[model samples]
Target: MSNGYGKKSNSPILASVLHGPRDLRLEIRSVSDPAPHELQIAIKRTGLCGSDVAYYKNFRNGDLQAVAPLSLGHESAGVVVAMGESVQGFHIGQRVALEVGVPCDDCRTCQRGRYNLCAKMRFRSSAKSVPHYQGCLQERINHPAKWCHKIPSHVSLDSAALLEPLSVAIHAVRRSFIEQGDTVVVYGAGTVGLLVAAMAKLSGATTVLISDVDSGRVEYALHNGFATKGYINTKTSPLTELSDKLMAAKETAVDVVDIACADQPDAEGADVTFDCTGKEICIQAGLYTTRPGGQLVMVGMGTPIQTLPVSAAHLREIDIIGIFRYANTYATGIKILSSGVLPCLDNMVTHRFQGLDAVPKAFEVAGRTVDHEGSLVLKVVIET
Candidate 1:
């Protein structure tokens, strides 16, 4: 099997598999032919995200732990090599982006068009399921044809891999309940956060402010036109303890919010707020940043349980809405990326490493605030 074709091989192909905390092994794994209603793909690229990094570093993401060794990648794109007899509208050599989640069609959530909330969903590279589904860190794998989306010829396979995150941003923005000329504030300037800010502006928001702990990322959001202004919650004191750090983060969010909210001429606070960091601190601060009767969208995943300022939410009438993955947003992602509405969008993949052997290195780079050359690290891609 090659980067473009996943042919049946007599010998197993190289795969990046995670054994435990800080233990990622390059093993040889065999891939079977596509089952009925499936398509075998030659994975070209996989982009690592915060969840992937958490699994690699802690063997878990939030409360979910890996029960067995698994290949840890979900944001990926590939080429169709072989299609099952039952597969339709697909052919060999066609470019596609893998959605990576397979849901039970009969589930009520799925039937209601909220497949992402289906209890029986098997999301690749996630430990939420008992027997975890394998990810796309290998050379080739078979997936359900219904979950594989064809991409335009102009969309590079590398960028197609990012469609997963783009879908997430789209979902977040849609749930934000943004209105024309509204003041919107986004917390966290990561790839998804930046995308959310840009989409909010395009959705008719007059003021968009993005916040992050990293100064470089905040600046990137401003210079890239993702946000009208950026805010960095700088470190004021050396907080060595976890509790202290979290508290300091919370205070920073408050500071950022206080400053931005005071500038709002039309409302007491932002019309809508986004907690893209998923950190309890960000969530707590959003309660204060958002105006009365405004909405706060939770898009990121953090610790399973944390203390929140429920009093602030109740008194301010802030609607704290949570989003679990994305529901029915892949097509929107494809259209936005195909239209090229975002300039320097491809540059978001700041670091690209070659081969499955570099998978570990890619994760290491993804966790860093700055690259070896002092450049900001946004997204890291592994090319197989």
Candidate 2:
């Protein structure tokens, strides 16, 4: 499809806007012209994320609270329709995955190749910043051309939209410092968790295991070959008594994960563990499951303050790494997705919505505790 819509029209574009908690509105807003270094893209697909659900249900996620109306959505892919004078290396009709965060290139972090931590970052759909950096839930959006990565012709726009979360997984895997043939365990079977599992296998992990409170997700991971083995947290436990709870959690994981990995009754530790669920119990379970001197990568954004097994980590000398949003991962993520190695990658989209008008219902569906078939909602995509 030709991406160029030609010159801007005087009419406004229909957009999905969030006024506050559970207050979503369909409105028309003036289209923005691309800046000297930007491209105006017609957003074709957007994946509704957990953060979006948090914003929709609570009007806040973590420390970020919405004080003003903001457009909602970040995981998006689109076609470049217009470009500014300074834009280069791209032309009209290019399919691109929009990197939602635009970092200030001059920042020290950016200079050091860690632009994801740029203090002046303007992240889409984030209300933490003043003047509210809006998102791509609109018909047209002007984004920095540098942050837009072109996708392979074989990649569907829907799949391209998922590169954002895949980038997060790539970053998590990178931070774990996984060695070839290392055993890896990923906690949580959500989109990021599943991607982490898939990436771990692709990174040459000897055995990859996944655990989730949702049985369906664990089953999905195992059946889809995302993980070599999967564990379902059949029961919920309160987050207390670190030592006792850690032991119990580890034993529980051993009972399930061991059957899948070692085919033995006894439990063994993984060389690396990834906690994609921010739940306190999941974090403890991941830490407890990692072997001494191994590594733990925390990728989930959960409660700001969490209780951790500090003594265990210190005694075991397990390296603990925390990652915020991804940096320098879009290219690698897109390349991996385009490689067509992940046969089940496209199946991750368990639900889909039609247009901007479906945005609210999309979010509502995304916020559901149970999915359409009463299973976990792995991923939801909105085609605009």
Task: Superpose all Cα atoms of candidate 2 onto the true structure and report the RMSD in Å to 1 decimal.
Answer: 2.8
In model 2, where do residues sit more than 4 Å from their true spots?
1-6, 9-11, 237-248, 260-268
Clash pairs of candidate 2? none
Candidate 1: stretches off by over 4 Å: 1-11, 235-266
Candidate 2, residues 263-314, lDDT tens digits: the string is 4334457888899978777787777788789898999999889777787789
Report the alpha-carbon TM-score of model 1 versus the true structure.
0.93
Per TM-score, the best of the predicted structures is 2
Q: Cα-based RMSD of the predictions, in order?
A: 3.0, 2.8
- Score each candidate by Cα lDDT: 0.85, 0.85
Write model 1 residue lDDT over 12-80, tens digit each, in one string: 678899999989999988877677788888999899999999999999998898999989899999998
